[model samples]
Target: EEPYVAVVYSDYLHLVCSSCFHEDAPLLIRKCKEAPLEACKGCHEVYYCGSACQQNDWKIHEAECKFLSTAVAVPSDIVRMIARLLIRRKRGDHDTFRAYNGRKFDDLMDHRSDFENMGANFDKVFNDTKNYVSIDYMVDREEIVRYVGKLLVNQFAIRGPVDTCIGNGLYIGICIFDHSCQPDLTRRSIGSKMILRSQNREQTLNKNLTVSYISPLACTEERRKLLRSNPFFFHCKCRKCEDTEQDGYARSIKCESCEGGICLVKDDSAPLRCMKCGITSSITHEEANKWNADVAIVEYFGSEDCALFIRKSMHIFSPPNMRDLAKKQS
Candidate 1:
């Protein structure tokens, strides 16, 4: 799906193409490398791969060209995207685009109550955006704030090589898909567009397509907490979220009786039961908690290497556990 608006992060303005969102030399495709990126002469804050890219991006960049030149520093990624949306609205371009379900920008959820509660945090971002956008585009402050809320919640992170986030983009059509902890659809970012692919084409053909807004590797509690958090405020009752058995398996411990088998402890008062062999496990919940704590330490404050993290966590987390899957994927 094509993005309504896309912007490179301020830190990557020089390294990434602002128009196509391509890296200077994309990994594994050295032959596709283009001439060195050139900063826009008008603003000098945005870069393009070539004249064609610069010309293509000029339509949206033109609105903020002079203003960006005047600013002490470039606005934040979200602010730049908001400015582009406002400029598009000012140019009567908002109505030109429609979502997969024919929803327009005004039809999208703004979650006004949540943003209002944000108070100073939201105000500060809006105020910063105002400095870069023209007065004509700022005629409707309330409407702008609404767009702020809409974009914050709807924007998709544009990922590059090795799933590194290069920037943010808004694809209204793709936003129509609901969030699921175990998603039916997976998204891949190519240039400025997003492609949603089905995990199981045959099974998902007639099913409602869902995507994981947060990492699919996240545990049920972590997934629900993130889904219900700010910018994406909604309690997820997805199949994965409602499955208690799945949650138990995720927190299971290595079995003491059986080789390579895992045991599940129903509660603190109960004995751990091996899933592979029906044997009662001698392992206690305290041991499981300690293993979890060790993984957390290495994950947050210890090693930065994903391979090392995964190696350290393998024996601790059971194979079927979400944390185990998360580490392996990382």
Candidate 2:
């Protein structure tokens, strides 16, 4: 059960339960002990799980319903979310919220400065969010800006079983997790809640917990660029970003040298290597044979030596000026 739950407009909410966020909300709601969902007459677009859910959600949705019942350009998703949060705060389930983020909401990371660093186009986006607030919500523009930044950096997209995006939600408790190019945690949303389990949930405790914010299928540079743009304004320095070999195999191909081996970014400068055979189509036989001599030594070497040797091999096999190997394969 969530301390709080919020849903988008009914058109977007669709068959999903507005209160609990269940996909089969309408069908399951029919089996409820309570009366059926109350559809708002104003728009015939809003529905609630029950009377209590209707009243609770109505506290915020009323204004939206009335406004939406009429013709107006629908607000951006972020603007609508900010509006909902403002009204929900007034309903005031203070104690329930205190358990997370110390309930300040202010304690949430501020991406305002991050946007400032990005320059004026970001400022325009922030300004556009503010423009949506003026007549509908009597809110402080600065407060809206802060919440907008928080939502951008913190909200998690609610995905269906097939990885289709169902909606988006914000959970203060789970937002504290730092991201990695290769995540240790996998996110699964059940209705309104975001659950993080160990990528290997069988074992618990501390084992380098992490989660990927972007697809690891992209090569290192692509992931870094995506993370540094818009919402996430920082370049990733994760191990995978530093070493291209960590690229996920979804984008990889079968190696010519060893048909069984996956050809992946083994050299940061250019060549793709056969993971099992340690052979590269781009690396000449003479060079590969020489490099292969160090494999046993690399295996026995300390972590620091292994890293250095790998870098040396990359420089030797694919000079820095050469084009990226993954792009060529793509």
Candidate 3:
């Protein structure tokens, strides 16, 4: 709990109480004053649940208040956390750099080679952050870029009481686990701190544990792609990815030749192979394009919203296509 660093809630994310980092904050804004929620005299963009929280947070908030007051465009979320860390470090808060389980900032992997390997896109993001969020305190631009790189891979996107994301933080302690398609540990947020527990209650008999960073229901390809793209820039050799494409096959259509066989394809360009009868099926450009667009919308929405989105998509796809997808999800 001592290591839990609560970030300043951004109005951009509709968060309440920059101190406690609660969500749906605007709903509580009106009554916050008489309810004794204090607004910052500097920039009313943020608020506090009480004076104690305001006082405890001000050490880190001073620079952000100054930055927010002057800037026309708000800094991105990553920059704000980095700014807080920097401010805390300047204030002699050693805990700011110390990660959970006795790990230091230097201990986390920076992915320097990975960023360099990304080439053009890396330069674009790096340059954009520097140009947009460069503060006067850090004279060297490379320092900020380094912090950004470490954070991109190491930071956790914090969730609130609502499923919506409220802020981002670097949990030095929780960063110890490696990736597994079927993780042994799961996490839930309670106020500012995240609580982690063994997926199997009996499994906790052994203290050492691991957790999966991504959703297990995801196919091997989706899991690998997610791991490789962001901070953890490596291919996953987890049991699920190593075993079979059954999950991918489950989500895919039946083979055209052998309607009983599941059709398995690595990507849009690859031909779908029949798991039972071994039929290789080719997908048209139009079919692939529409399938991707529909998948994106379906995955992004909540359960209630997903059904409505799928219902809307029914107008675009053929009945046969919808029936196949319905079977896949089931």
Every candidate's lDDT: 0.73, 0.57, 0.59
**What RMSD, rounded to one decimal, does every model reach?**
6.0, 11.6, 6.8
TM-score of 3: 0.66
In the range 172-284, model 1's lDDT, one tens digit per residue, is 87887788876777677777779876635465432367887876544566677788878888899988789857656766777667787888633344677788898986667
- Candidate 2 residues 1-330, lDDT tens each? 142334554355545556555554333323224445556667666666666666656766776676556535555666667766665655564234653445445557868888768762444545554554446454565776777788878777775433446667776666666889656665666656666656354856342567777655455666788998988888899887786544434234445665456654433445766668988666543344344333333322345765566555454433321122222111
lDDT of 1: 0.73
TM values, all candidates: 0.78, 0.65, 0.66
The full ranking of all candidates by lDDT, starting with the best, is: 1, 3, 2
- Could you tell me the C-alpha RMSD of candidate 2 in Å? 11.6
Say which prediction, candidate 1 or candidate 2, comes out ahead on lDDT.
Answer: 1
Ranking by TM-score: 1, 3, 2
CA shift of 211, model 1, Å = 1.2
Better of 1 and 2 by TM-score: 1
What does the lDDT read for residue 225 in candidate 3?
88
